[model samples]
Target: MQYQAPVDDMMFLVKDVFSLTERLGDIADFADFDEDLYAAILEEAGKFATGVLQPINRSGDEEGCQYNDGVVTTPKGFKEAYQAYVEGGWQSITADPNYGGQGLPKALHVLIEEMFYSANTSFCLYGSLTGGATQLLQAHADEATKQKYLPNLISGQWSGSMCLTEAHAGSDLGLLKTKAEPNDDGSYSLEGSKIFITGGEHDMAENIIHLVLARLPDAPAGPKGISLFLVPKFMVNDDGSLGERNGIECGSIEHKMGIKASSTCVMNMDDAKGWLIGPPHQGLRCMFTMMNLERLSIGIQGIGLGEMAFQQADAYARDRLQGRANDGEAPAALIKHGDVQRMLNTMESFNKAGRALGVWLGSYLDETFHSKDQSKVKTADIMSAWLTPIAKAYFTDAGYETCTIGQQVFGGHGYVREWGMEQHVRDCRIAQIYEGTNGIQALDLIGRKLIGSKGEYLKVFLSEVNSDLVTMPDSAHKNQVSELLTELEQLSETIISRSASNSEIPQLVACDYLHYVALVTYSYLWLKMEVAAQGKLDQQSAFFFKRILTRTLGLKASIESEL
Candidate 1:
């Protein structure tokens, strides 16, 4: 079966819930953006996805990536297709315009990402990593560094990688052994081995620009001592031409269960030529600038996979002939059976909630970037920070389950290789593990976000939701809204209060707490979406609206059961 982009739902969320085109400030660069252009962009993105990228997703997975000696080769067609993506201007959508980027709002890019991710996750990772690496450099790198690297990265002429993890130092950066020594020329010589570096050694571009994390001499112990450096695979001249090899080599690439098309290489940096980003001993802080972007981007990845899985399952259920309906109307496809319909309905609604949350977070980031109002910007910042971990962990966690349920719709065929449903499950499984394992994300949420600064962030989130609930008028959603708000508030208070006494309390309940927040957040967004859809409901829109409300109501039961 072919994949179809959920255009109507995506546009509705962007236009109504996000208002990206309508509410963007008078930022000089964004002044020309309008609804029609935004729609056209999304339409073209969908076409590129369905026509160009989706056709190769399964093949990429089947072929995976290959390594000969130290050189890595992506699956057949990846290099050419990636070049096409670059020519299409996708690599620069949200990058700095001064560096050959289009400088568009991230909300628009969010739609593009969903399609790109859905079309081919492994392929999209190469481009996404470059965008993320470029964001880090643009924000923190020096003039010489930026002048040399940014344009190529933004143009996708060269790709990029983040070298953060070692075999022993995955999340605990304080334990890392990569070293950087100062040279007379004010540059650094970096020597280290990094594991699980996505896009580290692929031959998809002219060069691979690596943003590596290393500890300098005489630095303090622990994470405070770590610093970031721009270490390219090949040295570049003043005119941005390629020079000699920079001593960074792919020792080997990982054999992974999913996203096999994207090389996860073990990189060895032996006295590599490097330039530092940001101040000494403040690398982690600068790294967060890129990580925060990638974290949310990863969440969107999970949401996209879920959306695609739901689409695939819904299409399969509609066409696959199976048992008779419980109502005894007639023998029909699996979709006509009540149990199967319930599962598809559940999958559909969950994907909607995930998309709404994902896009809403994207909207929040857009507002954070463009809003002139300080209070709004600050509010958006706090919300974005507080919700970042939840968004990444919960969405991915749910995405795994959603994909599994999607495969269930295909039964035996789903378990087999040819069907491609299993690929969604395999690719999505790693999201929960990487980007700081979901457990780490949960710990960060409750430890740093919820209880940090004496529960200030959680208070801000709950308070805002509470305030929103008051304006919800006397519709059928009112009671549901009020109940959900109350439940979430109680959970927040319970976790916050208990975590104060025991250090382990937060960790113990964090996964559950994350689920609680996600369920409630979806409930809240469902209320908002239903309200938005009312004024603009066409035939299909009305049906979708009703389904969203039903799903929101059903979630109350699921969440309550967890409690």
Candidate 2:
């Protein structure tokens, strides 16, 4: 199936539903961007996604990446496509202008990102990590370090990767054994091996700047003692030219279940000369800056793949002739079947609402980063922290489900490689696993964001929801969502209270609570979209209210039962 960017729906969410332009107009950084500019940027991005990226997706997957000694080679056309991406200035969209970046709003960048992921997830992964790493360095790296690295990274001449995981440690960062010894010249020599490092040793860029987490010789134990370092693939001369290769080498690449085109490597660092990113024993804190951004991007991965899957399924359902309908004498297309319609509606509802939710979160990210008002920045920061896990876990969870439903729409054909639905399923699966597993995200939502804050995050979220509810005209959908919100508030209090006595309660109910919150969140977005559409998306809205929103009832029941 062909991949087309949902530029129209994205535009609707950005302009009509979210009103991002007016919201961000007060910020000096975003004053130049209007609806027209957003559309033009998205249009060109859509073309690149559809034309350059999508074409090589299947071939790239089929060819996969080739590993030879310490070097890893991407599949055919991958290099050219990456070069085109860099030349198009796609990498600079949301970076700082001083470092050769476009300095666009994250609200706008999110939409373009969705298009890239939707077009070709594997192809897009190589660049997505770079974006995350760029943000991390911007927020945490020192001035001199930024001057030496930020420009090349932002311009896409070089790419970046986050090196955190090891063979023994996954989500538990404290268990990591990567060692960093201080040198006489003030630099650190990192000696550790990182596994499952995406774009770790790819041939796409001139240099790969690795943000590695390791321990100092005299550092304390556990996560607190961890520190972040910037380890480049090749040593750079003072004139900004590439010099000798660094001590880091790709021991081997993982033969992954999916995203075969993107290199997932096991990097062995042997006395790799590095510079610390943030303060000592504060690596995890600094890394969260990058991890949080990557979580959002990973959430988009789910949205993008689901969009692609839905398009393929919807197109196939409309064209493929099958059994007869009750009213029709002739054999009807699969779309005529009630069951097929149900599946398609489910996929469409999630995809559209998921996109809207992503943009909604993007708005908060914009405020957190660019807003001058401290109050707005603080609230945005809280909201972003609370919602990041949901965005990562729920979007990907829903995305995986949507892909499966899309595959089911094709019946047996979806299982094969010819239709491309199965590939989407495989590709999207990793989003949930990596960037911290969905389970880990659920734990974070329940433990740190909700309970740790003494329900402050939840209160902030509900306040925002209630404020929006006041503006929406009276309707059953609105009332239902409001009722759900009230129930969620009560449920949250109960969970918090119970957690004080029984620590196991939160862990047991975290996943369900996440789903419950996500369902309600999607319902709220759907309600807003219904109002914003002025009857344009009535059918889709009705489907969400009638069929999709009902899932929350069971999720709530599960949570209550657990409590």
Candidate 3:
């Protein structure tokens, strides 16, 4: 299936629904950018995604990556594709200008990322990790570390990996056993093995910088004692020249169910020379800077694949002949079937709302970083934190479902690899498992963000929802969303109150509570899109209101039953 970037839909959200350009204009850094520039960027990004990335996706998947001795070779055309990506200056879109970056608004960057992901998710993973690493180093790395590493990282001359998971320790960082002993020269020697490390040992860049989590010798136990390190594949001299090889080596690469082209390496760091990123014994705090960004990017992976699935399904439905419609004598296309239309509509609603929610979160991220107002920065930070897990968990869950539905549309054809539908289903499956399982995301939402904040974050979210609600005209769609919001607000209070008496209440109901929140949030976004469309998207909006928004009712019931 040919992947096309939905540039028009994206423009509508940025220019109309979200008004991203106008909102970011208040920030001096993004004030000069206009809708025209955003359009041009999306157009060019779409070209790269279609012409360069999409063609290689199937071939890459079939060939996969090869690991021989200590070297990991990416699938054919990956190196050249990555080079074109770097040469086009795509890597520096939202990086710090001080570090050889373009310093563009992240709101715009999110849209471009969606296109890349839709075109080729495995290919996009290589660059996405680097983006997250640069963000982390920019936030926590010291002046010397920043100057030494940021330029190459931001410019895509080098890549990065997040080495957090060990064989025994997956979600629980407190159980990590990697050790980091300080050297006499102010560097540290890291000795440990990390598994499921994406882009850990790729040949796409000149160097691979690993942001690893390890415990210091003199520190206490568990997560708190863990520290972040910048361990490079090769050492650098005083004049920024490459020196002797470091001790880090790729033990092997995983033959994964999907994203096979993206090397998932098992890295062994034997006395690897490294520099500390932030203050000692505060690694998790520092690593969250990268992990949170990665979580959001992973969410976009869902939206991208969902879009691809929908396009393929839609095209197939139009071409594939099936039973006659109603009383027709001759056979008709599958698109004539009501059930197929429902499936297609479901995918469309999820993709559209997921994309909008992603861009909404992206605007907040841009504000968090670029807004000069301290008050705005704090609020944006709170809002982004509250929405991150929702975007990650809900988007992936919905994306996976959308892919399956798309596969169903193809029937037996989907089961076979000939149609490429099954590949999407397999590729999207990992999004939920990695980046903190959706269940873990739910726990973080209910346990940490909601209850931990004493419901302060919930109030911030509802305040914006209510503000938007009042401005919207009174209609059935508006009324349904408003009613759902009220239910959500009341349900949240019930959960908070009940949690005072029971500690396990959060975990018991976390998943359902998250789904409830996501449904309501999507309903709200659909209303905004309805208003923004001015009748253009009326049919899609109606389908969402009548079909998709009703899922919240069962979710509310499940949460109440748990209580």
lDDT of all predictions = 0.81, 0.92, 0.93
Worst 10 residues of 2 by lDDT: 322-331
Candidates sorted by TM-score, descending order? 2, 3, 1
Per-residue lDDT tens digits of candidate 1, residues 46-160? 9888888988899889898999999998888888898889899889898878889888888778778878888888888888888889988887988878888999999999999
The residue ranges of model 3 lying beyond 4 angstroms of the native Cα positions read 327-329
TM-score of each: 0.94, 0.99, 0.99
The residue-by-residue lDDT of candidate 3 on 173-255, one tens digit each, is 99999999999999999999999999999889999899999999887888888999999999977788888999999999999
Task: Give model 3's TM-score versus the native structure.
Answer: 0.99
Clashing pairs in 2: none
How should the candidates be ordered by lDDT, best one leading?
Answer: 3, 2, 1
RMSD of each: 2.9, 0.8, 0.9
Indicate whether candidate 1 or candidate 3 has the larger TM-score: 3
Error of 1 at 60 (Å): 1.1
For model 1, the stretches where C-alpha displacement exceeds 4 angstroms are 26-28, 466-472, 535-563
At residue 523, what lDDT does model 3 achieve?
91
lDDT tens digits, residue span 6-29, model 2:
889989988999999998888898
